[model samples]
Target: MIWPPTRPAPDPVRPGEESVWDYPRPPRLEAVRARLRVVLGDAVIAETEAGFRVLETSHPPTYYLPPGDIAAGTLVNPRRGGICEWKGQARLFDVQGGGKAASGAAWTYPDPTPDFRAIAGYVAFYAGPMDACFVGPDRATPQPGTFYGGWITPGIVGPFKGAPGTMGW
Candidate 1:
């Protein structure tokens, strides 16, 4: 599902320049689903073996998922909100049932436009708070600072978005 009348296109990179072509693309959106289960604590979060895309931004790419696949029960409405020009208004969610029950843990767009409708109601976690997060075969680990979730897959190199030296780029 796509959204927003004016979605931001990927930046144009010059040939042989060390451009971070970090934007992700899924072969098939339905092929992936976030499987949620307790890892080391009461928190239940989703992991997908199928493919998903991660975009390049100041923050990490927001992982998109099918709405039916997310475990909605684990989320509680958060008072905070934000806006994305490409998507729409976003609402936050707190991770409940986890050991850290009141954590301002996740976010979603319930009524995004047609472009991003697939991710509507599908939640993405901060990765900092989740006990574990996985993209495909790799386990996601918390990146330094409060910012990123490393979807550590083989052959993928860093420093990913929020890492030290790459901060200003």
Candidate 2:
């Protein structure tokens, strides 16, 4: 198992919360009812309570919002593409709103693995490059570094995977 049972977890996690270190190796997809909101510049680019979260070891939850709930024409122009070992190929997008744009700041998996089929038409934004993303009243902190799009809230703890010396994690 990737989780070291003998390795003392960093923080004391309450009964109902999770520690990223103890998350599963293959990751899990779960429905999220938390009000998810994405902002870029002054515009509320996307907002939805119908979202999904992918939970994996050493990473924070990456929220995926439903397309219908997002603002019209917010995601325009296809950019590059990426491959996730677990989720399959993903198409990137340019998010333009409030007179500003973040190229390839968001992505979607049109055809995903069977395990991730529920999120096929959903979008996940990189909170680091976005103006803000909120889960209910608390604003999220983007997962550390530029490569991963996990959204970090106060509930999650990490020596999160994407930091300077943690790439091998």
Candidate 3:
């Protein structure tokens, strides 16, 4: 059963609290794939119908796709792993495309909960780790550090709560 019929309304921003209500909703199924183009150096990774998902975080946007669609051959198995309260445990991978590729860059929830079945077996990339990540028709250089992905567009206003110290806001 879907937990909430619709996402809960963001909490009200109190005085001195960082406002993050303007954050964009997860990209629609079509929008995410339309703007994605995978490349390995000069070679274009085949464009296929890969799954995509946006995790809720204060940082940039996170894009998820099936391992079959990604050039997994270039990924180096990493020893790090993490768990998500809403999803499940994640196994990390380091991109090994020479020194240009992002290291320890991707992660996957091999066995997510039923609600997150769409993301199961799919790998998600940190937009910050990629050289280029796009949303819709806009192409953006990934932000530095560990950002999720940003969906900021004209008329979009967001402070997206949960950055470094703004967790309780």
Candidate 4:
């Protein structure tokens, strides 16, 4: 593995599309107005139009919804946490709703670094574990890999990180 390895060529972007390769390296947090929804089993556990997304090079956006927009009794903080160089510490949450539960499927930064302070206490879900996740009306696929929580929507293109052999990137 090489440090500062060359990035793979990004997929061709059609009109009105976004290439993840064009995103910044340290990542950028941006407010989003499109409706974001997370469904588990038969329940819609989270929905919001006032969410935010973190975009980084070689990755699709990771959407964060306000805690107020999530259903009551759906998130259980389990004391598991992780550190991100860009976002600071993140506390993990188990998602329990719609007759199902997924452990560590969600996370939040109770006290985020200043760059991401706007999303403090907001939660981001791993779309792969949910029955469905949507950005606007488009169903989102989970970004490839076990670790990253990016949601791949229709308009986002990538040769994203997280696949095997990309860790060095």
Candidate 5:
């Protein structure tokens, strides 16, 4: 693939909406007050009004929930995880709730790079594997592709990366 292939035209941004194309590279981590919720089956595995989101060019925001808000005993087993040049090392987890388990459904940054220190020990779940994830009252759709954990809410728009032939972006 080409290095930094030309990005597709972004969808029009309506009032109070954000276009993923406008986000910065190397990402910007910002604290958010929006209510975020995650569910699996009948269980509400996590919910928080206090969290952070990492925004990057061509990507939807990845919401990170504080560990305290997650259901006890939900995140289990630390599987080997990958390093992000920007965020530092991430440790993966298998999430179990409502008698169901999704392997590698969550991740945390135990000791993040200084810029990301605010989110150390906070967890981010992959919306695709959960029964549902929400940002406020709107349900979130998963960012395309299996590798990214971004939660795409109605307030966000994208011709996001992670689709076929878009890897270089």
Candidate 6:
């Protein structure tokens, strides 16, 4: 049988690094032991090690923190939501922490698609809405462009999705 071609080389990243270009088409959910934290205003609104990450080509990981790790009563009803073709429907939440409030700062899939069952009822925050989001010690950069919420950190390389002229990707 003929061998399937290997993926073309990604832009060079240092050892022990990840390239978003090499991530798969359908996206992969991987368990992470890294200490993930989300801070808004002066509060650590959420933190967890028992978290999962969604990795898709040309995108940084959008971390889903278990609702248990989030501060009590931080996420409240706001009647907002959106649809994800892959993950199914998402319900948006307003977060108030450390005396700050950002509407639609967090979202969850109450019933995700079969492939993303691990994150059902789990919430992911928009890095832009928070003061900072951390994977280990590095604070994350919000993914470029208005619509996407992937978190960019130092070790993840990307030309990335969500930029102008990249909608086709």
Tell me how many clashing residue pairs each candidate has. Answer: 6, 0, 5, 0, 0, 0
TM-score of 6: 0.91
Per-residue CA lDDT of model 1 for 19-125, tens digit only, reads 22444432112334444322325444444443344455333344555445555566776655677666678778777554455466667778876766766766666
Sort by lDDT, top down from the best = 4, 5, 6, 2, 3, 1
Residue 65 error for model 6, in Å? Answer: 0.5
lDDT of each: 0.52, 0.88, 0.53, 0.93, 0.93, 0.88
Q: Pick the candidate with the highest lDDT.
A: 4
Which clashing pairs does model 3 show? 60-148, 60-149, 61-148, 61-149, 61-150
Q: What is the lDDT of candidate 5?
A: 0.93
At residue 75, candidate 2 shows an lDDT of: 94
Candidate 2: what lDDT?
A: 0.88
Q: Which portions of model 5 show Cα errors greater than 4 Å?
A: 1-4
Give lDDT tens digits, candidate 3, residues 93-164: 776542466667777888887767788777766555555445555554443334343433322224444344
Q: Give per-residue CA lDDT, model 2, range 30-56, as digits (tens).
A: 999989999988899999989999998
- Residue 79 lDDT, candidate 6, scale 0-100: 60
Off by over 4 Å in 6: 1-10
Clashes of 2: 0
- Model 2 bad stretches (over 4 Å): 1-9
Off by over 4 Å in 3: 1-33, 38-48, 55-61, 141-156
Q: Where is model 2 poorest over a 10-residue stretch in terms of lDDT?
A: 1-10
lDDT of 5 by residue, 1-169 (tens): 5667876889999999999999998899999898999999779999999989999999999999999999999999997699999998889999999999999999999999999999999999999999999988989999999999999988799888888887877
- For model 6, residues 1-169, the per-residue Cα lDDT tens digits are 2235333346788998899998987899999899999998888989999999999998899999998998898899846488988899899999989999998888999999999999998999999989999999999999988778899999899878887766666
**lDDT at 63, model 4:** 98
Clashing pairs in 6: none
